[model samples]
Target: MSPFLPLATVIGCGVVYHVAQKASGAVSPWPVLTIAYGAAFAVALFMLGLGWWGRGDAVRWPAARDCVASLALGLAAFGIEAGFFFVYRSGWPLSSAQVITNLSVTAVLAVTGIMVFGEHLTGARAVGLALAAGGATLIARG
Candidate 1:
C-alpha cells in the first residue's frame, strides 16, 4: 500500500474523532483528557508488547539527551492540551476553532518549510496555499 493511504486514514480519523468529541458536550475536560491519554498509552504499551514478545526486539531505550528532549516535548504537549481544554471551555464553536487553528498552523509550517527547510513551493503548491489563505480569511470573518 502507498504511504498516502495511511496518511489519509489518519487525517480522516482525526476529523471524525474531533467531531465526536465536540458532540459529546461539555464534560469535565480533565477526566476526558486523562481517559484519552490513558487509551493512547495503552495502545503504545500494546504495540511495545507486540514488538517485544512477538518480534523479540523488546526495548531500545533512548540516550540520556534524547530522554531529556522527550521530557521537554512532553511538557510542551501538556501545555497545548491544557490550553485546548481551556479554549473548549470558553464555548468556542468547534468548527471555527479547528479551521482557524489548522490554517494558522499550516501557514506557519509553510513559512517554516520555505525559510528553514529551504523547500521549494511548486506552482500547484502556491495555488493551494493561496486558496487555503482565502478560505481561512472567509472562515475568520464568519
Candidate 2:
C-alpha cells in the first residue's frame, strides 16, 4: 500500500474525530471517552483476529520490548484524547486547538527525529518548522 493512503486515512479520521468531539462537548468527558475507547478496542481486537485467521497463524504474544512500546503509545494516546476533550470543553475552538496541537506535536517530533533518531535536519526543514510554529501561534491568537 502507498504510504499516502495511510496518511490520508489518518487525516480524514482526525477531521471526523474532532468534529464528533466538538459535537459531544456537552457530555461528560470520561463517559464519552470510555464509549469511544471501548469501540476502538473492539475494532482493534477484531482486526487482530482477522489478520491471524487470514494468515493462518497462531496468536503470537508480543515481545517485551514491543509490549512496552505499545503500552507507552496507549498511555500517550489516552493523554491526547483526554486532554483534547477537556480543552474543547474549556472553550478552545476546534480549528485553533487542532492547529496548535498538531503543529506543536509536529515540531516536537521533528526535534525528536533529529536528536534521537539521527534523522537529518536540513535548512529547509528548519525554516519550515519555524514557520509552522509561527503559524500555530498566529492561529491561536487570532
Candidate 3:
C-alpha cells in the first residue's frame, strides 16, 4: 500500500459515515455511534490478531507518555464523531454539513499554520483558501 492510502481511507470513511448517519437519523445517534465504534474496534482487534499492524515482523509499542497522548486524542476523536452524528440527525444536509465542516477545518488549520507554525502561504494558496472559505460560507447558508 502507498503512503497516502490511509489518508484516503480516512476521507472515504468520513463521507460514508455522514451518509449513513443521515440515513439512520430516525434511530438514536448514541446507538449508531456505539455500533459503529464497536464494529471498528472489532475490526482493529482482528487485524491485530492477524498480525497486520506492525512492520514486516515487528510489533512496536509506544512510550507511556505517547500512550497517554494517544488516549487523549482518541477521546477527542470519539467526542467529535458523536457530536457529528448528533448534528447529522438534527436535519443538517449532508452535503452542506460536510462541506462546511471540511472547509472550516481547513481554514482553521491554515490559520494555525500561519500563526503557530509561521508557515507562509503563497499568493495562489491564499486565493485558493479564500475561495474555499467563501464556498463553505455559501454551503452553510444554503
Candidate 4:
C-alpha cells in the first residue's frame, strides 16, 4: 500500500470526526464513546476474521507485554476522545482545537520517535517543527 493511503484516511476521518464530535458534544462523552467503541469492536472483529481468512493468521493469545501495550493504547484512545469532547463542549473552536492538539502531539511524538525509536530528525524537519509551533501559537491566540 502506498504510504499516503493511510495518511489520507486519517486526514479524512479526522475531518468527519471533529464534526461529529462537535455535533454530539451536547451528549455525555462516555455514552458517545461507548457507542463509538462498540462499533469499533464490531469492525475489529470483522477485520480479524478477514486477516484469518486471507492471511492465514489465526487469533491467538497475545503476549503479556503486547496485551499491556494494547490495554494502554485503549486507555490513550479514550483520553483523546474524551479530552477533545470536553474541550469542544467547553467552547474551544474546532479550528484552534485540532491545530493545537495536532501540533503538540506531533512535536512530542517527534521527540519520542527520535529518542525511543531511534528515528532521525533532520535539520529541515527541525525547521518545519519550529514553523509548526509558531503557526499553532498564532492560531491559538487568533
Candidate 5:
C-alpha cells in the first residue's frame, strides 16, 4: 500500500474531524466522543463482518498484549479528541490547530522512533525535522 494513500486519508478525515470538533464546541466533549466512538465501533464491526478485519491476523482475536496496546491507543486517542475539544473551546482556530498538533506529534514520534525503536535518523529525516521546526515556528508566529 502506498503511504500517500493512508496519509491522504488522514488528511481528509482530519479536515472533517476538526470541522466537526469546532462545530461541537458548545457540547461536552465526553458525550461527543462517546457517540463518535460508538459510530466507529459500528463501522469497525461491519468491516470485521465483511471479513476485512486485519492483515491475515484480523480473523483471530487479538492476543493479550495486542489488547493492551489497543487499550493504550484508545486512551491516547481519547486524550487527543478531548484535548482538541478543549483547545477549540479555548479559541484555537481550525486552520492552525491541526497543523500545530500534527507538527508536534510528528516531532515527538520522530524522536521516539529513533531513540526507542532504534530507527535511523537519516539525513533526509534530519532535514525533514528541521523543515518541520521551521514551519512550526512560522505558523506559531502568524
Candidate 6:
C-alpha cells in the first residue's frame, strides 16, 4: 500500500481531532473523551472487518497478553487528549498549541529513539530536528 493514503488519513484526522477538542472546550473532557474513544473503537472494529473481508482471511484477533499494549495505548491516548483539551481551555491558541506539543513530543521521542532504541541521530535528521526546534521557538514566541 502506498504511504500517501495512510499519511493523508493521519493528517486529516489530526486536523479534525484538534478542531473537535477546541470546539468542545466548554464540555467536560471525560465525557468527550468517552464518546471519542467509543467512536474510535467502533471505527477500529469496522476497519478490521473490512480488512478481513478484503483479504478473504479469518480474523486474527490478538491474544489477551498481546492486547496489553493496546490497553496502555488507550490510557496514553486519553491522557494526551485530555491534556490537549485542558491546554485549549486554558486559552492556548489552536495554532501554537499543536505546534508546541508536536515539537516537544518529537524532541522527547527523538531522545528516546537515540538512547533506548539506539537509533542514530544522523546529520540530516539532526538538521531537520534543529529546523523544527527553531520553527517551534518562533511559533511559541508569537
lDDT per model vs. reference: 0.77, 0.87, 0.80, 0.91, 0.86, 0.88
Which pairs clash in model 1? none
lDDT (Cα, 0-100) at 96 in candidate 3: 90
lDDT of 6 by residue, 9-94 (tens): 89999999999888894667888888888998898888788785366577777888879987998888889989998999999989
Better of 2 and 4 by lDDT: 4
After superposition, candidate 1 runs with Cα above 4 Å error: 52-59
Q: Determine which window of 10 residues in candidate 5 has minimal summed lDDT.
A: 51-60
Q: What range of 10 consecutive residues in model 6 has the weakest lDDT sum?
A: 52-61
List where candidate 6 sits over 4 angstroms from the true fold. 63-65
Ranking by TM-score: 6, 2, 4, 5, 3, 1
Off by over 4 Å in 5: 1-4, 53-58
Q: Give the poorly placed runs of model 2, Cα more than 4 Å off.
A: 52-59
Prediction 5 global C-alpha lDDT:
0.86
- Candidate 6 has an lDDT of 0.88
List residue ranges in candidate 3 displaced over 4 A.
Answer: 51-57
Candidate 2: how large is its RMSD? Answer: 2.1
lDDT of 3 by residue, 25-134 (tens): 45666776678889989997777766655544554677999999989988987887877777776778888987877787888988899999999988999999899888
Quote model 3's TM-score.
0.82
How do the residues 37-117 of candidate 5 rate in per-residue lDDT, one tens digit apiece?
999999988778766534444476889999999999999999999999999999888877778889888989988998999
Q: TM-score for every candidate vs. truth?
A: 0.75, 0.89, 0.82, 0.89, 0.88, 0.90
Number of backbone collisions per candidate:
0, 0, 0, 0, 0, 0
Cα RMSDs, all models: 3.1, 2.1, 2.3, 2.0, 2.3, 1.8
Q: How far in Å is the alpha carbon of 109 misplaced in model 6?
A: 1.1
User: Which sequence of candidate numbers ranks them by lDDT, best first?
Assistant: 4, 6, 2, 5, 3, 1
- Between 1 and 3, whose TM-score is larger? 3
Query: What's the lDDT for residue 135 in model 4?
Result: 93
Q: List the residue pairs that clash in candidate 5.
A: none
